[model samples]
Target chain A: MELTRRDALAALAAVGATVGGGVLAGRYDPPRADAASDAGSGSAAEPTLSTDLLDLLDAAAEVVYPSGVDGRRTFVETYVLGRTENQPAYREGLQEAAAQLDAVARDWRGQPYADLDADVRDKLLRDLGVETAEPVADGTITERIRFYVVNDLLFAFYSSPTGGRLVGIENPIGHPGGIESYQRASMSPSSAERSGGTNER
Target chain B: MSADGGSGGSDGGVGDGIDRTPSPSADVCVVGSGPAGALVAHRLADEGANVVVLEAGPRFEFSERTAQQEQHIRPGMEDPWEMGGPRDAYSTEGRHYPLNAARVKGVGGSTLHWQGMVMRLHERDFEMQTRYGVGTDWPIDYDDLRPYYADAERAFGVAGAMDNPYAPPREEPFPLPAFPPSYSDSLFAEACERLEIDMHSVPNARNSEPYDDRAPCLGYGTCKPVCPSGAKYTAESHVAKAEAAGARVIDRVPVQRLEHDDAGETIEAAVYATPDGTEHRQTAGQFVLACGGVENARLLLLSASEQHPDGLANSSGAVGRFFMDHLFAGAGGRLDEPTRQNHVGFNTSETHQFYDDTEPVEGLKLEFLNYAGPSPVIEALGADTWGDELAEQLNESYGTHVAVGGLVEQLPDAENRITLDPDRRDDHGNPVPHVEWSLGERTERAIRRANEIQHAILGELGASIEWTVGPESTGPAYHQMGTTRMGSDPGQSVVDADCRTHDLSNLWVVGSSVFPTGGAMNPTLTIAALSLRTAEALSASLSDP
Candidate 1:
C-alpha cells in the first residue's frame, strides 16, 4: 500500500499500459491500507493504485453495484487494476477519470473524494461533465467512465462461476461445476413465497 | 499405402496450367470439418474409403475451448472460440442474421456453438411445392431420410421420446431417454395443454443418459455459447471418430478452389493454402463440400475457371441462389415470482400446434424459454443506475424472466439470394457472400400473425410481455440455409437427390446449403440426415465402380 515511485513504475511494468509522459510523480492519498492488504486476491498487490484513486474506486464500486446480503468485496479494486494494467483503452480513460475526479473535488468542496459525503459524491458524479443536453443512453465521456469503471466491475463479478451461484444458477456455462436439476421457485401463487419470493413487479 | 490406398487417376487439368505436385490424397476430399463434413468423412473412412477432411480453421481441444468459454462467459464478451476464421471475410455481410456467425470455420464447424436441438425437418418440408404450392420440393422426401435420421440420432446420441403424439411418425424409438423439463418448461407445457396446443419435449443431441462415449447434460444452461460438460454433441465428436477410423484431418488448410480437367465434368484436385502461405494440391476421386450454407456457395463461386466462367457447377446458375433462413419472432414477460430457472434446462419444450405446412403458415414452431432474462436486461441497463435500485429490481426480475418465441417458415425467393459481394473481399481477396435477405409477403404476414399469437398467449398467462421482435421483425436466427438448394430437376437447383452437382460428376454439396425448402425448425438434424444419406450413396457408387 506504500505509494513509492518504485511501486508506481513496477505496477506500470506489470500491466504494461502506456505510462503517460505527463507524470511519474508518486502520490500517497491512501485509503484503509490494512483492509486492502487483508483482501484475499493476490492480484490486488501487483497494481499501483494511489490511495486517492483506490478510495475513489471503492466509493465508485459501492455506488455502481450496491451490496446485497452477501455484500460487495473489493471487486472494483481488482477490476480497476486488471483493466488499467492489462487493457490500454481502459487505462487511458480511467487515468483521465482520476484527473477529472480530482478537478471536480477541488472546485465544489475542497476535500478528497473519500472525505466527501455520499450524497455529495453522488451529486458530483450525477453532474459530471456530460456531452448532450438531453439524456444519453450511450456515447458520452461521462458514460465512458461508467462503462470503463463500473461495468467492468459488474462483469468481473457476474461472469465468474461464483457470481452465478450467488443468484441460484448452480452453474453458469463456463463453470466446470455441473448442475443436475433446476432449483427454481414454483411459478404458482400458492407456492410463490417458498423462499421469501414475492411478485416480481 | 494410406488406409484408403487406391490408384486414383487424375481426372482433369493435369497438363494445362496451375502447376503443383498432386499429393496422393484420400479417395474422397471433404472440405470443412463441421457436422456434415465430419459425418460423411467418418462414415466413408469406416467404410474403408480414404477420406481427408480439410478444416478452414484450427482444431480446438476441449480444454482450450473450455478456457476460451470461461473468459467469454463473462458479460459483454464474445468468445473468440465461437468466431469464424480468415477464409470468411467474403462471407460476413449478414444484414439480417448475426454478423459474427457468418460461418464458424473451425474443425467442429458451427456445431461448436449450437444449442444441440436435433429435430427433423417436417415431412411436408420436403414437399413444399407439392403440399403448399410454394417453393420447390426436395428431390427426396422424409421417407428416404427416415432411416438416415435414425442412424444420425444414434451417431449424435440424440435423446427424446419416440412416441410423441404431436411429432411426425418415426420408424424407431429414440436412442436415449428425454431429459426432464425444468419448472419453467413444465409451466409452459401446462399452459399449452390448457390452450389445447400440442407442446412436446424437443429432441436433443445432448445426452439425457450417457449413450455415446460423451457424458450426459449436467444442466449448465449455456448450450449455445459453450457446453462445459461436453454433454452437447459438437462436430469435434464426429471429427474424432473420422480420425480414429483412419480419415486424415488437415486443419488450418483452406481449400482455395477445385481444379477440373479439360472436359470440365469432374473434379481433379483440391488446391489449398496453409497458414504460412504454403500451397498444396490434394488429388481425389470425389470432392464433398460441407462448408455450411454461405461458404459452400461462395467456394463454388470462387472456383470460376477458364472452362466454367459462370463458376463451377453453375450450369443452372443456381449455386448461390435461393438463399433461405427461418424467420423467428415472439415476445417474453415476467411471471409473478422468480422464474429465472428457465435457463436451468436445455431447449426443453416446443409447440407444434401452429404448424400447418400450407401456403399461409407452414412454419410456425413456438419455443418456451427456460432461463433468467435479466442477464441481457441488466447488461442493457449498464452500470449506471444499475447499482442500488436497479440491482434490487434485477434480483427480483432475473428470477422471474419468462419468454416465448418461435420460428416462422420462409419460402424460397430468387431475389432473396446469396451473391458475391462486389464491394467487400476476404483476406484471400475472394469475394464474400452478399446476402439479399429481403422477406416476402408470406414471411411478413407470418411475423405479424406470430406477434399477435405471442401477445395473446402471454396475455392469457397473465404475465407482462418484456421482449419481442425477431427474424422478419428484427434479426435472423443465423440458421442460414438453401444457398445451394437441391431438387430433382437440374435446371432449378444446384444439386441433385444425392446432393451431387449437375454440371460436375464427382462434386457433391452437403449441409443446409442443399436444403430445397427449410421447415420452421432447427436444420442441424436434417443436415446430418442428408449428409449420412449422401455418404451411403457415395460409398455405394465408389464400391460399384
Candidate 2:
C-alpha cells in the first residue's frame, strides 16, 4: 500500500491523539516527561503564556494540524494549555513568539493584536514565519519559537502509542530478517527521494 | 604466621591451610564476567571444577529495559562514542596510547550491546609477527586453535557458515545455518559481487534458528540497548550455564587487587569490595583475570605490594602494552537499483577481498561488512548534510541503499600501551585504567590505501558516495584488543603460552588482552576460543599434584 506524506501526517495526528489520551489515562509511564520536568525544574522559575497568547497559539497549532477527530484539541491542549503550566522553556518560547506576532500584526495592519480580525491574524502569522520585521540575528525570537513548537509537536506525537504504531516503531521486540530485505531494496534513489531522505533509515 | 591465618593442612603455611571451615572458595576464580570470563567459567564448571566468577556490574535484562529506560542508563546509549575516561586517554604524540577499550561493568559485559557480527581471523593472522615485522606471533597457531573455534561456535549458536568460503576451515558446520540476508545486506552483496569483492554471509553469534532454548532473533531494531530475545549471545548466557554447572557467580563484587606472598611468585588471594562497599577476600587454587584488556592490566598494575614493587606480574615489564583495535571508516551511497531491503537479519553478509597477502605491505587485511538502519540521529545527520534532498532520497531508498565498509587490521606497537591513571578512579574508588595509544605509520598507510581500494570497489558496484570517514583517520572505533599479549618469551610479554603470568604462577589472563594482533575480524569468537583453551588447561593443571 502506497502512503502519501499527507496520509502519514494524518496517521501521525490520529496516533498522537490516541497516545496523548492513553498517556493521560495511565496506560504507560511518561518517562521522558518525568525526565524533562526534572531537568527543567532546577530552581529556575517557569514562565507562562497569557490567556490571550495561549488562545492565539491554539489557533496557530489548529491551522497546522487540521485533521483527525481530536487533532485540534490535542495540539491546543498539549502545547497551549498543558505545556504552559509545566514546561518553562515551552512557555518562554511561546510568549516570545506571541510578542513577535503582535509586533508584526501592529506593523502590517496598523492595529493592536487584540483589535486584529481573524483573516488579518492568519495573514500576519504566515508573513511573520516567512519574513523578520526586526533586524534579527540568526536565531530570532520567531525562529526559536517555531523550532520549539515543531519539536514539541513531534515529541508529543512520537511518544504516543498510536503514533508509534503507525510509524512502525515497535517496542523492545526482535525481528531478525524482516526489515533487512526492505532496507536493501529501499536503498534505491526512489525511496530516498520519496522520504526526502529526511527520516533516518 | 599471621593474625588472619587459618588451621594448617597440607602445606602448614598461613593462607595455604585447608581448614574445611566451610569458607567460601572456588577451585578457579575468573575475574570479569565478560565474554572471556564467561566462557572460561562455563568451560571450567563443565569440566567439574568449582569456578567462582566476579563481575563489577549489575545483571542486565533486556526485557526489563524500555527504550526510554536505556536512554536513562547513560547518554549516547545507542551510539558508541568515547566520552573521556581511562580508556579514552592518548599520549601527546597523537599516536593512540592504548585508548580503544570499551568495557561494560555488567553480567554480560559489553556483549550485552554488541553489533552481533562474528567472524574468525584468517589463517595468516596467526603468523603476522613472522610474515610482517609487526606484532607478535600467537603461541598457538590457527590450526591448533581451529577445534576450539568450532566448539565456541556451537556454544554460542552462530548463524552463517555455508556460503562463506573465505571463512576459516571448519571441522564441523555451524550449529545453525546462515541467517537470511537483510535487504541492506543483499543490496550490498550485489554491489560487492559487481565489484568482484566476493560478498558472502557474515557469521554472527546471534541465532538465526532456535538453538539451546534461546529464541531466534526477533526484529526489535534495538540491538544497541539490549536484545529483547536471548538470540544475541551475551556472557550472561555462559554465566548461567556455568552457574547451572555449579559455578558460583558473585555479582556487584569488584576485585580491587591481587595479594601475593613475600616471594611474590604465587598469588595468595584476590581482595575485592562488595556492592555495599564492604571489603572481602576470596582464596582460590588458581586465578584468571579476564577483566578485559584495560581493567585486567589496570588491576595487575594497581596491585603494587612490597614484594613486587612494579606490580604483581610486571617483572618482565610487559603487563599492559601493544593495545590495538581495527580502524573502521567508510562511505555509503545510493545504488542505481533499489536493493536496500528491510530484511531483519542484522549482519547477514560480509566481504574479505582486502584480506590476505595480496597487499605489498606485509601486515594488513581488510574485511568489508554491511551496516543499515540508520538511527534517528544518523538519519538527522544525513538530512542536515543533504538538506531538502534527504527526505525524498531516504523515502525511496529507506532500506535499499548498500553500506559496505572494511574492518582493517591494526599492527601492534609497544608504544600503544594501556596503563593505570595515577589519579582517576571509578565509582568504587578503584583507580580507572589509563590508555595511551596511537596508530603507527604502517597502520596509517594501510588504512589510506585500503580506503582507496574500498572506494574503487564501491564505485565499480554502481553505488554513489554519501559520506566516508577513514581507515587512517582518528575516530572512536569500538573494537578493542591487545595490551596484555600472550607469548613464549616472558621477557617481552605478560602471559606465557597458556595465558599465565610469568611472575605469578597462579595468575592467568583471558580475553583480547592476550591477543598479540588485532585482526580484521571481530575478537569475541577468538576470545571465546582462547578462554575455552585456558579453562581446559587450568582444569587439567588443577587435577595434577
Measured against the true two-chain complex, the DockQ scores of the candidates, in the order shown, are 0.16, 0.16
Compose the digit string of candidate 2's lDDT tens values, residues B54-137.
776566654553332223222223322223443233332344433333456778777876767777788878887687766678
- Please, what are the lDDT tens digits per residue for candidate 1 over residues B31-98? 99999999999999999999888877777777555445434443333455646444555433335556
Q: Worst lDDT window (10 residues) for model 1 chain A?
A: A130-139
Q: Give the CA lDDT, 0 to 100, for residue B247 in model 1.
A: 88
The deviation in Å at residue B306 for candidate 1 is 2.8
The 10 consecutive residues of candidate 2 chain B with the worst lDDT sum are B380-389
> At residue B298, what lDDT does model 1 achieve?
79
**TM per candidate:** 0.78, 0.73
Model 2, runs deviating above 4 Å: A1-201, B1-23, B68-101, B189-191, B336-345, B358-373, B376-401, B426-431, B471-476
Runs in model 1 deviating more than 4 A are: A1-47, A51-65, A68-149, A159-183, A186-201, B1-23, B70-79, B82-87, B90-99, B357-361, B376-381, B470-472
Instruction: Give the lDDT of residue B476 in candidate 1.
Output: 72
